[model samples]
Target: MKATLLSGIPLLIMTAIGIALIAQGKSADGRSTLAVGVIIAAVAGSSVIYQIGGWDLRRQSLAHFAIMLVTVLPALLLSGWFPLDSISGYFVVIAAFLAAGLVLWISFYLIFTKVVPRKADSSDAVRMP
Candidate 1:
């Protein structure tokens, strides 16, 4: 809950700022900031899932990654915002998605499997020097 709030608050704030900026005629900057906020929110939300889902986090994360790859990127590309009709363009899109998913997975593995477990262990007793 705490991690979710911490992550979500920034997402909300940045999204608000993005809307405000767009209202003020700074559409480009506002859009970029809004995108950043969404990315941060997704990463933070993943952490919250780890906190809550226990054994199901991997499935959840992988599903989210796969959904984003199959739906989100194609939607963006077809929306005609970027030049993604060429072979190189498709390559760039795939590479970017894979890279993003890899980063997210690595972070999830390290935090949930490594750092969080260490913190939860009760065997951290101090030893005499």
Candidate 2:
């Protein structure tokens, strides 16, 4: 879809810039930039996905958020953000992260729908004989 493609361009560009900054040893700045970029991309871009993916904005947002979380979770865990010596501890940390992600996805999806709104379709036009 055009929306999906358009949404991705900014993400790719900003993420690439963030990665470049990280590579140049600006870790803290780069990390935050990357996060901000992701948030912006996910929040703004989700409207496109929401429209094209039908009215299932929650599902689409969750799917996208899950993909991003999968990419980032291992890094966070390995960096000691969530200690994982015991099995139960692992489950706890994972659950906490999942819960957080769910909250974020839902909040963003709701905000995107509210802020962006749906384009009025011609199909909605009143017709008379």
Q: Candidate 1 lDDT, tens digit per residue, 31-79?
A: 7777667666655555544455455766767656765665445544443
What's the CA RMSD for each of the models? 4.9, 5.2
Q: Which stretches of candidate 1 lie over 4 Å from their true place?
A: 1-4, 63-91, 107-129
Q: Which ten residues in a row have the lowest lDDT in candidate 1?
A: 72-81
lDDT, candidate 2, 1-39, per-residue tens: 665666577778878988998899988667666765655
lDDT of each: 0.68, 0.66
Task: Provide the lDDT at 109 for model 1.
Answer: 81
lDDT of 2: 0.66
lDDT of 1 at 48: 48
